[model samples]
Target: MSNKSSLNLEAINDFIVNWLKSYAENAKVKGFVVGISGGIDSALTSTLCAQTGFPTLCVEMPIHQAESHVNRANEHIDQLKARFSNVFNERVDLTPVFEMFKNQVSTSDNEAVLNLTLANTRARLRMTTLYYLGGLHGFLVVGTGNKIEDFGVGFYTKYGDGGVDISPIADLMKSEVRQLAAYLQVPDSILKAKPTDGLFGDDRSDEDQLGASYDELEWAMLEVEKGKKPEDFEGRKAEVLKIYKRLNSSNQHKMQAIPVCLLPDKLKLL
Candidate 1:
């Protein structure tokens, strides 16, 4: 991982913008559709897509969302549309749809499981909505996941936020995402706001859920990448390393391709 100060922000920005343009051209898609969560990642992704001179749709799907989250999302979208002629936004209030979904599903006695399942349902609903809009407009569903969440800890909902046609920032660490976002002139509110999935409809943050800050997680991820073991650290460093390893191991199913049981060619012929 490169230090934020050392990253070539200009080069990175140009590369991503060109990559997005080329990919969209190759796929024969008109543009991109991104889900905006009032977070830094989405803000940056939409900005990059807009820089490609393609139509960038920023969709806000709120399902019993926090006022702060909704406000920030709107703030970013307004700023984006002001800056780029190609940027457009849509707000889809999914609270009623979510309530209807709960009405149709079985309830669980376990509070933790029920809460997690519902939170994930919120994400999947947003995913489906993005795809729906994309299908209508011949656009690709842009993903907002950064490298750490997409691969390191896999802290995203599988097939929810994880579902997308492309991920623009999946190679950048969270710190790097913030740095690049800053360079791209993303709203300061989003850059400074604590990171969250906004799935729980509460004020809980990504750190509150992950048990470690992104900076700490990034360090742990780099150490593990360099073949360092938990035994090589002490105190908080060791604890963070353990947390990173646990998440990375458990979320392998989300990070890897779906498993396939291969049978012999002869069996297939029979």
Candidate 2:
């Protein structure tokens, strides 16, 4: 998010690889299981996992995913497999599973909420598939979300993309991720590809839904973090602030831990 590019890709890669290896050893897990969506975040995350010398299960769980998205996903996996001996690629199409789910849910009057529910179902189904694979193979589910998506706007689904044993690049901003992906030699096509969750049939990009570019959001998020008010943006204050507030407020729930009621000794008597 900072205009200053201070990220040391080599160091980041080394740190992530070491973390994965140590995590696997300490957690007694066999390897890392990653859900690849052909996006830069997943590609970078999977690459880091593969570099750890542990068997990395790179899965493409496509549920009504776009053809371009599918192609890019395969290309990235092929590249990773070609270079990293520990990289194992798997493609699990969940279209049938999603269709079955749609059939089961009762029709609702609110079409908008229904569509959103179905989209969230797609993400949760993918989460289920990742955990199933991890459970069967004794691997840890590695998530692909970057800082901007995971924290800035809470762009990920809870118990869905948000479900994972580890997150390697959750601290890196979207811009920083692109820089790291380029350094990792992620395929040029993938490195230059538009960022999308590939969850909807309409094939909308993240920027499209967010109504602001990652650069803009990143700047605004940083400003918010610095305790700067919307008025600080000067001429574009109102416009940028609107985008910032809408995104931060709408997705705040995803960024937080599940709520639980705590009881003290006296309250426990109830």
Candidate 3:
């Protein structure tokens, strides 16, 4: 497996920036909009978008977001705006909107299901806000998902964070993301902070929810690609493999293309 030390950070950065610029120009859009989550992924994404020289709008949609998250997000946005002439930012507090949505929906007796549903709701609401802003400004909604979250474990909401016009860093692993982030001068605060989706209004790290670190998950993903099975491993390795497999299986719907019910030719003719 290729390690982060072997990555050509400068070349990778140039390629992604050029790609973002070319896609936006070909699509005939004004610029790009990204939801800044104060995490490494979003920081790197917004930075790449800004480097494209297009108008990159970094939006903070906080719905009961933790103070650390808000601070890091603001810090990163501020740094980006100061560094790049094309960078812009917006703060849209969605706490009240989320509360109103909860009131409109029926309550669930299952605590786990209810919490999960609300977390997804937060993601969807942020997605809606991003699209609304994008539509108004002719900006493409840029996604902040990394390779592991988007493909390996499907750690993102279906249409929420998954809904994006373009993904610049989806091809890079989590370790590679941190490498590029440091190369691009992302804030030290975010670099050191724990990764979180920030949907549950708490400080629970992504590792806490995934049951394995990105390093473990990446190893398991690579092993699976090499046709390895759970029985081939033992101890902590086996546990991590099972965790990776469980998430990969359950989240295939998110990773794969949406299903379309196609009618037969005869039925269509009839």
Candidate 4:
């Protein structure tokens, strides 16, 4: 969304390298625990963390019921398994977890809530695995989310995909994610692929879930960046604001740090 001109990804990578170094040193974190879903987002994120010298632990979490997509997801993991030095690649089948939570929980009359609940379950399950790894090695979880998918459409599950110690690429739009993927020389299979949560039907993708493509989301975000509303664009006004609220409202908490009231002595000697 920060203009269509290509970015100097070397500078981007350099900035992240310093950020990662400072973050780990200050936080005293052992390393990074990354969830690699064989998707472009995860692949690009993992590659960035690894290239920047973090000992990234990449996990492939999938529900056994969705075995086919799981297999497809592993291909992305396999590529990284061959690259990172201290990578931990494991496939934890989440079928039992999903089944247990699904059976014990009673749904309300709302179908939308039901679907969202299931998706959140999948997301939380993945986060559980990531956190487990983080606990084992004192690593911090690295988020794979990008601006367009989670930030633009409010598509991620709160407290689910929202759980992370740090996000290396949360500021990036979906198109910019692909651009970084290209910069990292990520495989073409992932570079040009559709983005999906792998929580719903195998056919469902991010664009379909959001009712708009990355191109549309990018246009809308750019318009917002220029302090213009959807009405300024003529026919797309309604659609633009609809997404504007989604992008703006849904990501409110994600864009901020939790409130920690300053103590009286906190500013004593700054």
Best by lDDT: 1
Q: Write the per-residue lDDT of candidate 3 for residues 8-114, one digit (tens) a residue.
A: 88999999999999999999999999999999999999999999999999999999999999999999999999999999999999999999999988998999999
| Candidates' C-alpha lDDT | 0.94, 0.88, 0.93, 0.76
* Greater-lDDT candidate between 1 and 2: 1
Q: Of models 3 and 4, which has the larger lDDT?
A: 3
Total backbone clashes of candidate 4, pairs 3 or more residues apart or in separate chains: 0
Question: What is the per-residue lDDT of model 4 for residues 1-270, given as tens digits with 9 covering 90 to 100?
Answer: 334667888898778768887898899888888887767888888887787576778787776434545655676667766876756576677788888988897878898888777888889888888898899889999888887656666667777778888988888877777887888878777776677777774668877777777777777877777787766666655586567667667667755678797878866868
Candidate 1 vs candidate 4: the lDDT winner is 1
Considering summed lDDT, which 10 consecutive residues are worst modelled in model 3?
Answer: 1-10
State candidate 1's TM-score: 0.98
Q: For residues 67-122, what per-residue lDDT tens digits would candidate 1 score against the true structure?
A: 99899999999999999999998999999999999999999999999999999999
lDDT of 4 at 17: 65
TM-scores of the models, in the order given: 0.98, 0.95, 0.98, 0.86
lDDT of 2 by residue, 1-270 (tens): 344477888988898889889989999989999999888999999999999898999999988888888899999999999999989978898999899888887978898888887888899999999999999999999989988888888888889999998999998989999998999999998988888887777778888888888888888888888888776666665577678878889888888777888878897685
Worst 10 residues of 2 by lDDT: 232-241
Candidate 4: stretches off by over 4 Å: 1-3, 64-68, 250-270
Error of 1 at 49 (Å): 0.5
- Cα error, residue 248 of model 3, in Å, equals 0.5
